[model samples]
Target: MRVLWKIEMWCRKQAAAAILPLLLVGWLTGESSQALTTFGKSNTQPPKEVAPTAPPARPCSRQAECAGISSSSCVRTHYDSVTRCLCGDNSPPLNGQCEAQSKLLYHVCANSDECNDGLVCGAPNITGNAQPHLRVLTPQDKICLCDTESGYREREYTCSDAEILKTSIFAIIFVTSLRKILFY
Candidate 1:
């Protein structure tokens, strides 16, 4: 029965091979479990989120906008003293369009009478437009006398005659007083 003996030997070899792997795996698992007791923080749960740290930042929409565009001079600005979106080319505010070609004329009254002698205030002399006329926004019979050309200075007056009279009286008094003092 040598054939029967050979079959029995083969079965015994297979059983030993399978049992050896299972024993090795059991040994590894047992070693790992022993490590858990000494793991300390590693074995514990994670820390809490705790108020989410900080508020979410505003996201940028346009890709073409430069990096840090909010702080960049090109887009940076203020609205009535409050920080605002950067509007246009870096120049004095010219209306809302913020055209680099134009400038904001520091004005007082809508008419020339409301501004100072050296200064002027009025709408643009729009002759190139389809409707060619000086913009009529003042109360002086549709007249706007404040605006001037590059080299000439215009006499600035006011809408009220009382103001003009007051200045005239002051000038006359000062001149007459100076003349008397000088002569006497």
Candidate 2:
């Protein structure tokens, strides 16, 4: 009789656990869906379409002709034999302009913004050292480096100036300690 009571109590607890979650989820879902339906029904009108904007004008014949345009100055560029006045070198890239190249190695970066528009800032994950050592990169060591598959195929990581000095000092100390271990 005691064993039967224990089994019944365990079954009841298990059933309660299983049913409680289902009940809670159903109640929450019903409330949310009711609220969503009420909100959605009130906004029955279709969204209005907006006209597309035109790009900034690039109008010039001579290199000196484009000096008055906003956010862009004058520069001479040759395309297929015609030398014409175009946007200057310092102009920020336009909406459809392609990115120039991947981020160069060892360019100092605090975050992704300091790097080029698309490149991330991080070091490579290197292995295969004679001595197994764990390495943790600080904020300084994180430079404006390209992702691995973005044609930046350097096996080793690039470091900032401060990181270089710190790493070199640590390397010297570690080598000397290894030598002492070998000699003793």
**Whole-model lDDT values for every prediction:** 0.37, 0.43
**Model 1: residues >4 Å from true position, as ranges?**
1-124, 129-165
Task: Give the per-residue lDDT digits (tens) of candidate 2, residues 39-102.
Answer: 4367666898988664433534332343344323222222212222223232333553423333
Model 1: lDDT to the true structure: 0.37
Backbone clash total, candidate 1: 4
For residues 1-184, write the lDDT of model 1, one tens digit per residue: 9999989877876775665445445444666445544545454657877773432222222212222432211221122221222222223332333233211122213355443343455543434451211222122322223334533333222223445567668767765675455334
Per-candidate TM equals: 0.18, 0.19
User: Which regions of candidate 2 are displaced past 4 Å?
Assistant: 1-160
Q: Evaluated with lDDT, which candidate comes out highest?
A: 2
Q: Tell me the deviation in Å of residue 162 in model 2.
A: 0.4
- 103 in model 2: Cα distance from truth in Å? 7.4
